[model samples]
Target chain A: MHFEYQVDGGNFSNAGVASSQFKKILKQLNVDPGLIKRIVVALYEAEVNIVAHAYRGIIKIDVNIDKVRIALIDEGPGIPDISKAMEAGFSTASPKVREMGFGAGMGLQNIRNNVDQLDIESVVGKGTKVEFEVNLG
Target chain B: MLVSELKEKLNLKVFGGNSGLNREITGGYTSDLLSDVMGFADQGKLWITLQTHRNVMAIASLKDLSAILLVKGQQPDADMLELAEEEGIAVLGSDENSFEVSGKVFNSLMQKS
Candidate 1:
């Protein structure tokens, strides 16, 4: 199964809706609970990053019998240093984003830690694409 | 231990979820950061955090957490409470700090075994 979600960056309240929907689909598909937990972690972190930092974005989840893949593409200020951004305590989020209990600089690292595979591509003047995969097997 | 016992021992307020709902909490994770909570929290465990944001509830639902306890007497926003009610996730509030609440919850689970 596949799902596409348009993340509205304007509303902080709606940020996790995409991940929530995908989690439900995974549960109904009888995905392993551990894999499902990892997917949820990665998905929500990626989604929160997009909403908190990006101007706007879309999150897509593709699931098969053997694995699940999530891609988050955002039209936000691209990270200048991918390596530093991957560090656990690096964040450029504004005060408002931090007020919502996110932007703690843990987003990228947390996503990397939870997923089986992680790929991040970004251009300073353009945007970012984060793709992660988890083997359901 | 079930959510009811946690509520009674902690003297927490049941801001959401059916009070009589029976669910066992095997462990606890407490953090204000959603990312850390996501990466560290175990499934079917209790989560204690200071955040009252909507995504907190969303994460709890995704994680299949046994319950959520808002520490330091914090109350989630109305929308957050509403969503928790809809998702059937137990929501509680306590006057204790996150550390205190987590320790108490941990001790409670340990005693039950």
Candidate 2:
């Protein structure tokens, strides 16, 4: 199965809609509880990243018999250094975003920890694309 | 322990999601950083934080958390309360800080076990 969602940048109010919906789908499909938790965490972090930093984004999910893949593509000021962005405490979020209890720089790291595979591609002044997959088997 | 039990035991104020007060609580996590809780907090945990934004309800619901306990007498944003009601994840309030609230919750849950 495949699903796509549009993420509105700077909209904290609707940040986790995709993750929540995807979680329900996973539950209905009877995915393992542990795997579902990991996928939901990764998806939620990715969703928050777009709302906190990007201008706008798209989230695409592809679920197969053995694995699930998530792609988040955003049009915004891309990361200048992927390595730095992946660090635990590095963030470019504005003070307003931080005041909402996010932008602590743990977003990507959390994605990495929860997903089996992670690929991040970015171009300065353009946009970014993050892809991750978790095995359901 | 159930959320209603915790609220009664800790004397927490219910801010929203009264429908979910019967949800079960397996554990508790206290963190102000949304990502920290999203990354490390487990399912069925009650999140204790000072954040009172709508995103907190999103996180709580997405994480399948038992409830959210706002510390230091913090109150939820109007939108946060609305989302909590919609999502059915209890939003609670307390006059204590994270340290005190977490400690008390831990002790109470431990006693239950």
What's the TM-score of each model vs. the native? 0.92, 0.97
Off by over 4 Å in 2: none
Model 1, which residues run further than 4 Å from truth? Answer: none
List, for all models, the DockQ compared with the true complex. Answer: 0.78, 0.91
lDDT of 1 at B37: 78
Worst window of 10 by summed lDDT in candidate 2 chain A: A96-105
User: What range of 10 consecutive residues in model 2 chain B has the weakest lDDT sum?
Assistant: B54-63
Residue lDDT tens for model 1, B1-113: 88888788768899887742477888888788777777777778888888887788888887778888898989888988888888888889889888887888888888888
Residue B109 lDDT (model 2): 100
Identify the CAPRI category of the predicted complex in candidate 1: medium
Q: What CA root-mean-square deviation does each model show from the true structure?
A: 1.8, 1.0
